[model samples]
Target chain A: MYDYSSRPSRLPLPVDERMASADIDLGQRKSIYRSLQELRQFEKRAHDLFLQNLVKGTTHLSLGMEAVAAGFGAAMRPDDYTFATYRGHAHALARGMEMGPAMAELLGRSNGVLGGKGGSMHLTDVSRGMMGSYAIIGAHLCIANGAAWSAQMRGSGQVTVCFFGDGTTNIGAFHEALNMAKVWQLPVVFVCENNLYMEYTPIDLITAVPHPAADRAASYGLESVIVDGNDPDAVYLAAGKAIGRAREGGGPALIEATTYRTGGHSRADPAKYRPLEEVEAWAQRDPIPMYHARLLGLGVAEGELSSIERDVAADVDAATEFAKAGEEPTGEALLTEVYADGSSRWRN
Target chain B: MAELTYREAVAAGIAQEMRRDPSLVMLGEDVAAAGGVFKTTVGLLDEFGPDRVRDTPISEQAILGAAMGASMTGVPVIAEIMFSDFLAVCWDMIANEIAKSRYMTDGQVSFPLVIRTANGGAARFGAQHSQSVENWAMMIPGLKVVAPSTPADTVALMAAAVRDPDPVIFFEHKSLFATKGEVPEVEVVGRLGEASIVREGSDATVAALALMVPRALEAADRLQQEEGISVEVIDVRSLVPLDTKTLLASVEKTSRLFTVEENPRLCGWGAELISIVGEEAFWNLDGPLVRITTPHIPLPAAASLEDLAIPSVDRIYETVKSSLR
Candidate 1:
């Protein structure tokens, strides 16, 4: 078990020193902390549900990567689009997807976001600008670039943020998309959530560069930045700048947020591939507890923090109940919606 | 009506659509300042400017992926893959992302994407450049496969493809680029899933696609004049949402079914049509279904070998004449 108390005595805070010196206000600071807690707690519940065999298919969790979601989500406008990888529940939640529909989707319920057709790997909330998630590594990069290109063509000023892992940077599509983005001056921010592990293998084993953003960004001519992903304030500050620049037609930027998954790659694996000390160290630096510590240091009351936690707990419980009660889709429903105009008339 | 070559009709159609809808963007290698390789998109950069008519790196995956992404955001994208043979390089984006987006999103998303690529073996472009992989696209459920045979149909169908709420694989034939035909002066949009009777006859029904449509027509004229066999030619414009109604009607009248395509004989576009006709109008046929296609060999670079590979007018004429017996 990890400690949740936000005490300065935890010594050498796992986060960057900049978090302590950042100019974030008390209210905004509290909100960021609360968002991380909510995401963390929600993900924990989802993992529990997966263990209980309620989640129909396997799900990739962002257990310790909540700050990246909370920070990036808070910075972007609701109208701004985001394309994320399969470990995308936090992104969808942060981008304003309702917990009921999101959880229902995991349970493969009829009321699920994608009507249960797309389970955990393919969560989409178009209205809130969570364009969709892709399971294929590096596939969504060009798609996000295209969305940004669309924004540029229409002069919408909507910045498209694409979230992928460190492993995805090595994929061919990633390089192609970044190159196209730079050449076209697309208004997009490519966020590589450098979680160290691409599934079982460490990213360094496969990736050619020391840092994905450092080497690849220069090649693509994209304005690049690196941030402590565990620190929400740092991510918010860096991501906000990148997104702002993109919205203002400064072209694309690469923000490599270095963090760790702190969980198994998927539902089945015990993650025997990783070292015990590495896992334990990542656990201690869990974003939720780290954020809690910062909130306490910033003068947040223990009771106030407890109240936010209680509300989040209640919300997640309600979501579970709603998902359990969701109806199972019929075979007839599957035939529908294959085509927009329902031109897949043969199925009918 | 104005006389326009098949290539001109495609360009005119795209330019007309781009003018009407500002969100329609074109992206491909050499499509912008240099115009397209075949010059089908000539003067588009001058008219629409670089942004709408843009050039892309030699990245088919990016071209398709970006086009799909753009389509999801309400911008209709027409991405030219240079040639249908190269579609294999970007098959994942087409088969996985573009084809499955709407279905996987449970209708929450729609990809108004048009993938325009030149199909068929002609001009000794060899195995790499020349291939009629229309059947590969036809097998994918979500895609709308269209191969226009005439300039008018090319202009009309190109309009429909751009406006479609789904992904459309528009296969343009390299051989028919300079083939002249009359196109409407006013803008016309060909309806998807509709077939055109290019040459009407009574003895046998020859359902053809792409480059084979002209050959089937030539064969029909020759058969009528020489052999006194009235051959009905059906231009299978849309392969995915196939115009089975017109095909069945034609087959019912002619009482014989023949499919002409430049795709390989084994498991080609003809194979699917044969099955469909066998299932639906099998009892109505006067004889067995005939499929004329390129031999199942990689198109050789040599002209003599290529001639032996691709189906010719002589082959179609002889087949129809022999089938009548």
Candidate 2:
């Protein structure tokens, strides 16, 4: 229902004027655009699968918050670690997780990303440096510090990027992690995607500060950085700066990207709490179409953008079929991986 | 062999592991320069330097969460949580994150970390500080729970926990910190899930862990000398990866089983053991299985109340003596 060809007229500046100052090259720009498309298509397929009753349990999607994950994922090295929250399908895909395994994971198949043990909330592909997608709020922030500490101890020079929702800023572990990260000078970057709503309620109703993560940055001795989450180039620039500083031992940085989730928090909720005017206003700033128009305005060919979309659609379709074809996890899988010895046996 | 107190052996055990593995790191509140609140981790900072042996703020979640994250990335970490009771504050990190990370990830990323805490009652730190919560860790499926009674076992188990590939919760009894035992001069690593039959007998079998081990030993000696009741005592060291072979064999030989526990009565570690024995060794039992445990109540700071709550040597002796008679 939204217009993809025309740019939003409400913007203060044109797409070229806003993105012209970004330092990213043409190749990186194309890659970020491609990542955005892939994320959007992948999440759409997941939602469709959920409606079809194939994805058991529940899933938290990053439908409109693709730029945050794609931007940070683009800036990160292949070997760098990524810790994200439950709404991590975007982050997982951005880190180069194969769509087949990712979709299979959501479907609870044997060949799923975590072999179906982790289900939808915990999509982990450590091989791709996607360490984990944590379901519990604020827990992975502390865990991210540990990964950064490991890199510091080993002199690996690898930065750890941790992503969470705006809701996490108010949690106790969030403050603890931020304080510890700063005190230790860990090489980590904390990214907060402020999607206006924290599940059913607006973040401002529960949060004390105007900017949840950025306002609290000074409390942890971090610089307050706010970026436009709907703008891929802006997110890329902010993510690159933070990740670069952390990699060079400048310590951790917190970037609060203001975005909006177009869908409900999960498949269960209808998101009826959101006002109609607010939802319509955010739909105009949708990251996918906004970036799509921006790329076209920046001397990109319409055929090239169309080709990328076609490729992403094919990939998503193949991935869906692959997930549908995967075998159910065997009963023996239930008892395995509880310990290092590959068995859950506690007694001899 | 050298005589070392339980507290001293904690440092020695950790220092030994840190020496062997350069990737091994330790962090906790007051654990580095301050040498731990219980003085269990003295000289770690001086030897390992500030980089590896670092002190963290009093954040239990951060301490354990950082340990979990580091271990996932190939660095084995030893985190001290100060007190076993404080684990409740960071229970989400330990229970949901660290314990389930490996299993949830289907073994793609494993957490090779050790969470060593000063556990059990006796210092009269009150209910908040004093608690034998190994049973709390025991109920979790992925954690390996261990409590050592002697200095030698402390050092040995610490070494084993550091070298292990899974997350281990090492509970050191506060009362036994001053208890001295003979530890080998050479590096010694003990296996997990193995119970030590400190004293062997055929009349009755008594199982105890941590601070209860020495008390059970003394009770067994007293029962032999005064009441002429031959009693076998087993140090049921590791709760998870439980040494059921030794325990069931002991029960078969003695035909009577008694558990001396410091945990509260409800859902204590002894309850699990009794259930396992009751199901597996029911025909071998000559009498009903008895458990001497703390009453289902919070520990009080008053010395008299505390003493009456925890099972004493006289209580173990009397319980076993009357049960046998």
TM-score of chain A of each: 0.93, 0.95
Q: Note the DockQ of each predicted structure.
A: 0.60, 0.86
**Could you tell me the C-alpha RMSD of candidate 2 in Å?**
3.4
Question: Each model's TM-score?
Answer: 0.96, 0.97
In terms of lDDT, the best-performing candidate is 2
Local distance difference test, candidate 1: 0.87
Interface CA root-mean-square deviation for model 2: 0.6
Q: Where is model 2 more than 4 Å wrong at Cα?
A: A1-16
Candidate 1 residue-wise lDDT, B1-325, digit = tens: 9999999988998998999998789999999888899889998999999878989999988999889889999889999999999999899898888888787778889998899999888789999999889999988878988999889999999999988888999999998999999998998888888988988888899999988888899989999999999999999889878888898889899889999989887889888878988998988988999999888888898998888788889999999898897
Residue-wise lDDT of candidate 1 within A1-348, one digit each (tens)? 332122112111356866776887788777777688778878899899988989867989998899899999888987999999899999999998999999999999998998888899999999999999999987799899999989998889999999999888888999999999999899999998988777877777677887876568888876567788888989999888999999998999999988888777898767766666666777787777777777888788989998999988999999999999999988867877767785456320
lDDT digits (tens) for residues A1-348 of candidate 2: 432213322221223355755667988988999999999999999998988999989989999889999998899999999999999899999999999999999999998988999988998888899999999999999999999999998999999999999999999999999999999999999999999778877787788998999999999888889888888999999988899999999999999998888889998878877666667777888888888777787889999999999999999999999999999999999999999999999999
Give the residue spans of candidate 1 off by over 4 A.
Answer: A1-14, A346-348
Error of 2 at B166 (Å): 0.3
lDDT value, residue B316 of candidate 1: 96
lDDT, candidate 2, at B164: 89
